[model samples]
Target: MGIEPKNLAGWSDLLEQAVKDTLIPSMKTQEYTWDTTDIVSDPKRLAAFVALSSAGESIQVGFSGEPSDVASVVSQMFGFDDLEDAGDDYSEILDGLAEIINIVAGALHRSLSSDGNNLQLSIPLLIHGEIVIQGKEEWVAHRLTIGDNNIDAIIIRGLIQKQKD
Candidate 1:
């Protein structure tokens, strides 16, 4: 099962802290500041999601933002002096996107698991378009700013699926 609705706020705070503690520094830049914001909108953007599970409970975390902004952060994370140094290929950009999520998710996993939750994480998946929800899972969405980039973070609590006997 997913994290309960009642605990979502606390978990949201943890998630935001994880982002601040992990994502910002990993960008390898000092100009970026992390702060809560409204959900973002960009016609074309880059996104990634990672699934974190513990025993019967699980949640999905996602990060998405405009392509240019994401690419800028990724470039900085890679220590590239400029975007061109990071390459112009789409696949390369996607890989960079996946890498950042992996870093953030891995850190989050370690923190939660340390508290005896024993969380496991799926590989970060690069996605296009919106996150699709097929069940009645409770979720929380938070938008954060990294410098001028507006990135959206989504947490979708898992719903336990029963098996037929």
Candidate 2:
């Protein structure tokens, strides 16, 4: 069993709060949107690159620009050391993105879970390659807008069970 419907609602509420509490305060978020698409073709490869070592199912979230920009903003918001790219190793860049995703997801999980239980999160995976977003017959596309930026968060509700079977 992974996250449930009722729990997913909780996640959504928490995600909204996280944006207000963390991302919005730090950056001038413009036109934000929440949506989910199938990971059909690895929409963003950077996310997957970061998660390769962690072996956990991943959900893709699309933001604006390159890793550096995202990293810089997130680092400042979280009060962490600036992320620098030493050479071409993208792992570092992906690591920063993962952190942001983790924060958002963790916050959502906590808000939804009973007794404030923490949800286990896999290391953040960064997908950099071109990805094709498509919806299945049973799944319809969903979207939400915040500020000027479009935030896309996908949910893998029964990911664990799917993997097991």
Candidate 3:
């Protein structure tokens, strides 16, 4: 089994901490602060999703926000005054977003592995549209506000199963 169902909340809390701890201090922009964690839909234009799997169970993490906000984050992460400085290329922006999710997943992976959860992380998937969650799937999403930007981090437990015909 993967993370126990009863321990999901605790894991989610840890995920929140991972995001805050990873971004708060290292970010170039200092005005950004921890806002709140709440259940929210995917309203952002860009998103990156990664998953951790162990013993046939999986936990997926998705980080999403607006393109401008994502660009801001990429700029901050790379120490660029603006993403435009790195060139106005769109693929670089997407890669930067993937890297952000990769960093957060790395942190979470270390924590969970330290606790004896032999988990393997999957490649980060970048999405440009909406994220749809099927019925019976457990989705725990949080809204994190940094400065004036709103980012959503979603945690999905269990594998997605297809309905029978």
Q: Using lDDT as the measure, which candidate wins?
A: 3
Model 2 C-alpha lDDT per residue in residues 1-165, reported as the tens digit of each score: 333333445544555675555565665454455565333333233332111012233333233234455555555556667454443555666666667666666555555456443345556545665433333312222243444333344443322111110
In candidate 2 the C-alpha lDDT for residue 127 amounts to 60
Which residue runs of candidate 3 sit more than 4 Å off their true CA positions?
A: 4-7, 29-44, 84-89, 158-165
Name the TM-score of candidate 2.
0.51
Off by over 4 Å in 1: 1-6, 27-43, 82-88, 159-165
Local accuracy of candidate 3 as per-residue lDDT tens digits, 38-91: 543443467778888888888888777777778887777777775745543557
Q: Name the TM-score of candidate 3.
A: 0.81
Indicate the worst ten consecutive residues by lDDT in candidate 2: 48-57
Model 2 CA lDDT for position 116: 42
Q: Would you list the C-alpha lDDT of every candidate in the order shown?
A: 0.67, 0.44, 0.72
In model 3, pairs of residues that clash are: none
Q: What's each prediction's TM-score? A: 0.77, 0.51, 0.81
Better of 1 and 3 by TM-score: 3
